[model samples]
Target: MARILIVDDAKFMRLTLSNILQKGEHHVVGEAENGTQAVEMFEAEQPDLVTMDITMPELNGLDAMKKILSNNPKAKIVMCSAMGQQKMVVEAIEAGAKDFIVKPFDESRVLEAINRVLG
Candidate 1:
């Protein structure tokens, strides 16, 4: 299983994602509370995959994704989105995110998206 870094402003959301990925046998290397932290964590940890939320304080997921990709094009990412963030989703893909998961998350869908992106 791949090593994964989870990024979300909400602590519970990050924990939920951690639990889901850990159960799926992916190593949860770290968690980030905001997009700026996400980018820093990604650079330091260099995990096999990252699950990033689209909206956050300091910097949004798309900008974080761009920074990460700018540093490492091969870095893999999946955006954690909310309903009706289609525009952000497109921006994420363009920024080099491999996939996305919409919130209020379904565990199965979360796992599926992770697998599709990093499996």
Candidate 2:
């Protein structure tokens, strides 16, 4: 199982993702409420994967992804974006996110994206 960091401003969303990942046997190493914290955790925890929300205060996920990738080019990230953010999602892939899961996550799709990226 992969070690994963769940980054979302909303505590509820983080909890939802944590449960989903745990049920799939992935270790939830840390939860970050903002991009800054996410970057710090990325360095400290060095998780195998990260699920990054597209929007947040302090710093957005796209910028955070860029920063994380700048520090670790090999980092694997899966963007967690809302339904109307297709533009951001595509940009994420271009900027090095391995995959994405649309918001209001579907368990199967989330797992599938994770598996694909890990592979």
Choose the strongest candidate by TM-score: 2
**Pairs with backbone N, CA or C atoms under 3 Å apart (clashes), candidate 2:** none
The alpha-carbon deviation from the true structure for residue 107 of candidate 1, after best TM-score superposition, in angstroms, is 1.2
Query: Which candidate's lDDT is highest?
Result: 2
Measured with C-alpha atoms, the lDDT of residue 85 in candidate 2 is: 98
TM-score of candidate 2 relative to the true fold: 0.98
lDDT of 2 at 20: 91
**In model 2, where do residues sit more than 4 Å from their true spots?**
none
Count of steric clashes across candidates, in order: 0, 0
lDDT of 2: 0.96
